[model samples]
Target: MTTREIVQKLWNLCNVLRDDGITYHQYVTELTYILFLKMMKERKQEAAIPEKYCWDRLRALHGEEMYRHYRELLTHLGTEAEDELIRQIYHNASTNIGEPKNLEKIIRSIDDLDWYSAREEGLGNLYEGLLEKNASEKKSGAGQYFTPRPLINVMVKLIDPQPGERCNDPAAGTFGFMIAADQYLREKTDDYFEVPKLKPFQINQAFTGCELVQETHRLALMNARLHGIEGKIYLGDTLSSLGTQMGGMDVILTNPPFGTKRGGERPTRNDLTFVTTNKQLNFLQHIYRALKKDGKARAAVVLPDNVLFQEGDGRRVREDLMDKCNLHTILRLPTGIFYAQGVKTNVLFFNRGTNDTGNTEEVWFYDLRTNMPSFGKRNALTEEHFGDFIRAYTAEDRTQVKDPRWSRFTREEIRAKGDTLDLGLIADESLSAYENLPDPIESAEEAIGKLERAAGLLSEVVEELKAAEGGNRK
Candidate 1:
């Protein structure tokens, strides 16, 4: 069967294993272990069992015996690996699929996957789905790994990642941006064939990423391997030691972890050079330090709206970003794009440079969220939505541009706004008057307007429901 067919079939069988206590993530993680073992076994093309463990032991058993041995084998394997996360995953896998029947079913399901065909896009899709499933589980807050694929594609396109240009994602979650950047370069250039053929001009190192969470690290490793990329991911925090660890990158694409630091606990003692509770700010600073002199990196960072408007260190970071880097674009995202509820996000596209000389010659703000369709996990934002932004950005030629998400912002404009990085258009008089009409005090008067609009919407829904019900009755 095709890899898609196999993954879909296995995913469907997951329902049988799940009950009151079980979740989709547990089933998928368990399947990952089984799938890894099966692939390794297939690749070696030998029944020559390593002293560690072999699939034959579990494959030979049947029914209750098969189930019991499978669980025991996983436990033994985890202990042998001596890794705590591996042990937890295996133990959790056992708890998730407690029944022997379910265990046998899972084994057989993965056994159906075609490992040879799996290496191409097939494996990537399966893992992407798995990552999405894990994110939805929200147990480990894995949703952070998902950085809106559409946004990443736009970032990759604007940066125009080539083979020779080194790509890095510190605080890389699931390595989505790095992987996408790789794919973009491969598709655009002639060098890469069935497999990625690195051009001499194309960055030989290809990609590098840093991930802190153990499971995420494993998935990132697996993702790189599945894509035929080798030895570029590091299992550590990128913020604290990125300069030493990563050296310098041509392009750094990342969405650092969001949240303020507490007083008692900081990420590292010597790692953080600046003092502020905001971890994201520190990451931005680190990226500034990590970039080579005029190395030119386009980083698309997802930050809270506060980062654009907050005072103090937050203000300092924005000012520094504007001063030192080419603060080219800001795409304001709407609420509910994230699995984490009620998050309003914005993507800051900038590059590191030598001096704080020029005014932000042009800042393109793509208002995708406003007046755009309401989106959720079930029907999320896709690549098509970002087409305008990418086209507009590229038209600028990275050096000179007249028009495009493009608007020139003077230094005085920012200073007047208290050094805000909020790059929405400065409303002309008519627009400002229209916008001001929506003020909270005017909201009471606007309530009548809102009621009229809601009534119109409700009337439409009622008519649609009535038609459906009438059709059903007929």
Candidate 2:
């Protein structure tokens, strides 16, 4: 079977799991545990996994015995396994399957898949497909961690990470951005054959990230390993002291979790200048500060609309970002693309300056959100949607690019607007007619008609009340 077909077949098995009360998110996690073992066996790299707990041994068993053994296997690998990665993947793992027959059915179904074809298509691609499928299911609630793949690809392409440079995602969901960067470098360097000496650093140290959620962290580890990446994927909060230590990165790309810190708590990182409960604002502070101080260090970040216009710390953070970095490009993303339906977002592209002061001269804005189709399940966002913006971004002279959606503003102009980065130059054609006021006579007539309808309903209610009162008096 092709990788897509295999992913579909595996996802379909979730229906069987639903009877056992397994959620879509939980099912993906469960599948990861089983698939890791099978994948290692297919790759002929099962030295880390104990022979008894391996895929073939587990598949040979039957009934309750098999179910019990599987539970034991999970516990042993989690705590006692010699391989650290194996332990991380299986840590605190347990079966949610209540019936032994259900367990047997799942095992049988996985074992029956065409492994040869899957290997040919790449096991990493298969696993990623499953992740994408889960994220697309709104009921799964996995979309929060998963950024749209096309968006991720576009960001990676624009950043264009080179070999031997460190790239990180502090708010990594499934390590998608890091993985895409790796793939991009590989394609550019012919799998790093052109730079044999740098291959070790590229594979073992170039990519790293931190994830807050435990299950999500586990998925990140699995995803990284499947793609042959050995970079560190830490399990901890980036807003705490952990993030304080993550500096000197050459390139950073991330979509940090939205909303304020939990329970109105502030970040524990003492190094940040402006303190706030807003997670994105704090993340913004962390990202630019985390970059290498050299003029070449750069980053691209996804942030919400509130960060653009909110006063107090939000404005302070924007000013701070501009002062320390070039703050060159802002792409206002379209609505309905993320899992949260109406939450609008933008991408900030900038490079860390050697000197902290006056790095920003001008800011270019791309109004992609205005006059764009509502992007959702039926109308998905693609790389083609980013074509015009990308050409303008990479053009030798951005000023000469004659696109209506592209515009620029000087730093002086932004300062006049109270340092708010929320600038959109495009006038949406859909709302242009509404910008003009309606005829006074027509507006008054419409208001009167609505008032008359309300008065008629009130009269009927008053008559009914009077009749009821008269009946009681009689």
Candidate 3:
């Protein structure tokens, strides 16, 4: 079977699981557990798995017995396995299936597939497709972790991660960035993992990441191992003081969670000069700080409009970013491409800056969002969608492009505009239709997100009012 066929066959089991009250997110996680076991059994990596709880042992059982054994196997792997990959895959893992029949059916379905052909056809694509399915289903807010693969491909392509150089995603979501970088290395270099002699760093320490959420972290680890990349992914908060270690990375790519930190709590990390409740800004601070300051480090990050325009700490963080790293390219992304509608986002691509003169002299702005078709399931984002923008991404003079969607702004010019990177030269024709409106669901989600943010701010106001009242009472 082809990758798509394998994805379809595997994904169809999600329906049977749904009847058992298993969510789309839960179904995917469960599939990862089973799929890994099947693959391990196929590869016959005996050292990786204990003999008693092997795939064959679980497959031989029936009814509740099989379900019981499978549960035990997952538990055993979670706590007892010697292989780090196996251990990570099953860490905190539990079966979501409530029925033995459903469990049996899923096992049979997976067993029936042509693994030999599917392996050759590409299991990485198959698993990623499953992840995309779970993301598009809008389960457990999986969309937040799921950066569109097309966008990922473009970012990875732009960075062009090299062998032996460290690549990382602190907010690793599904570990898509690391996986894409790995694939890029293999294809572009025609280099296998065990190629023309491997150094220790090149083999074991090539790519790494840190994820706050355990479920997504587990998925990312499984994703990495399935692709034959032994990437180090830690399970911890990336924004916390004790979060993943910073600095020394050659390339960093990430899309941190959008929204403010609850209760206006900033990270305990004293390393960040300008602290704020804004999660993206905090991640932005960490990304540049994590980069090597010797001038070779580069990064591409996805951040919301608030980072570009908001004042106070937002401005401070942006300034820090500009001074420390080259805020060279900002790609205005189209709306509806994300699950959260109306959240205008942009990708900031820049390399680390070393001198007092500043690294970004003139920042290039590409307005891909303006007048572009709303990106959604009906009109999925693809490489072709980014064709024009990719071509516009040039080392040549900005005037040479002649594309109206492209423009450039000097650092001084940006500073004159109150240092707000929300600079756009062309007014989008779509702006006029603001009153005509967006889809009802999209509009509702946008309204909810705004209301939530406003409520958070209002709480701060309430506290301030109470503090004033107490002062007057005193």
Candidate 4:
């Protein structure tokens, strides 16, 4: 079977989990626990797992005994495994499969897949496909952890990470950005065979990231391993003392989790100059600060709209970012692309300056969000969607790029706007004029559709409020 087919078959087995009250996100995590054992066995690397709790041993037992032993296996590996990576994967792990038969069905289905084809296509690709599938399901809520692959690819291409340079993602989210950078360098270096001396550095030290969620960290580790990356993936909060130590990186790329910190608490990292509960603002500060001050160290970050226009600390963060780095490009991303469909986002591209004074001369803004098709499951965001922006970004003389979607502003002009980076968006004629209107009936139907969507959003807000009120009572 092809990798795509195998991913589909594996994802379909989640139906078996439904009766056990396992969510799609939980199902993927559970699959990772089982798949790791099988994959290790397939690759003849079972020494990391204990012989008694290995894949063959678990597969041989029937129903109840299998389930019982599986539970023990998780505990044993988590607490007693000789391999640190293995222990990390199993630490605090437990089965969500309440029924033994369902567990057996999942195991059987996984074992029946074509291992040869999976290996040929690369196990990492297969696993990534599964992650993508999970992210596409809006109800799964895995989208927050998963940046769109096309967006990741575009950012990686623009950043153009090189071998022997240290790269990081503080909010890794399955380590997609780092993995893409690894692949990009591997392709350019013939999987590092052409540059044999740098292979060790590229594999072991070139890519690093930190993930806050334990389960997500496990998946990140698994993803890194399947791709032959031995780089460090830390399991801790980056906003704490841990992030304070992560500095002097050559390149940084990330899409930090949106919204304010829980309980309105500021980041505990004392090194950051700005104090705010806005997670993205703090992450933005961390990213630029983490880069090397060699003028060559660069970063690309995904942030929400509020970061662009929020007052007080937001303005200070923007000013600080511009001062320390050449805040060159901002790509305002289209809506409905992320799992949180209502949140509009943007990509800020800049490089750390050797001297942290008056480094930014001008800023280029790419208006990709305006006049764009609504991107979602049916209308997907692809590499082609980035064609114009990419050309403009890489152009020798960006001024010659005559597209209306592409524009630039001087540092003085940005200052005039009170340091708000939320600039650029050509006048959208569709919203401004009714000269090209459809029939009245069509217009009425469109207005009704928008109202329905608004009502649905309000309903979600009400449910959230109710849940919060109940929690207060408790």
Could you say which candidate leads in TM-score? Answer: 4
Model 4, 25-81: lDDT tens digits are: 899999999999999998788987879988999999889999999999989988999
What is the descending lDDT order? Answer: 2, 4, 3, 1
Deviating ranges (above 4 Å) for candidate 4:
431-474
The C-alpha stretches of model 2 lying farther than 4 A from their native spots are: 431-474
Clash counts for the predictions, in order: 7, 0, 1, 0
Is 3 or 4 the stronger prediction by lDDT?
Answer: 4
Of 2 and 3, the candidate ahead on TM-score is 2
Question: Model 1 scores what on Cα lDDT?
Answer: 0.66
Q: For candidate 1, lDDT tens digit of each residue in 304-379?
A: 7878887888887777777677777787775556755556788887877766556255566765555444566545
Whole-model Cα lDDT of every candidate shown, in order: 0.66, 0.91, 0.83, 0.90
Q: Tell me each candidate's TM-score.
A: 0.76, 0.90, 0.90, 0.91
lDDT of 2: 0.91
Residue 160 in candidate 3, Cα distance off native in Å: 1.6
- Tell how far residue 394 is off in model 2, in angstroms: 0.2
* lDDT of model number 4: 0.90
* Candidate 1 residue spans exceeding 4 A from truth: 1-5, 41-52, 63-96, 113-121, 136-141, 190-204, 262-264, 269-273, 355-362, 397-406, 425-474
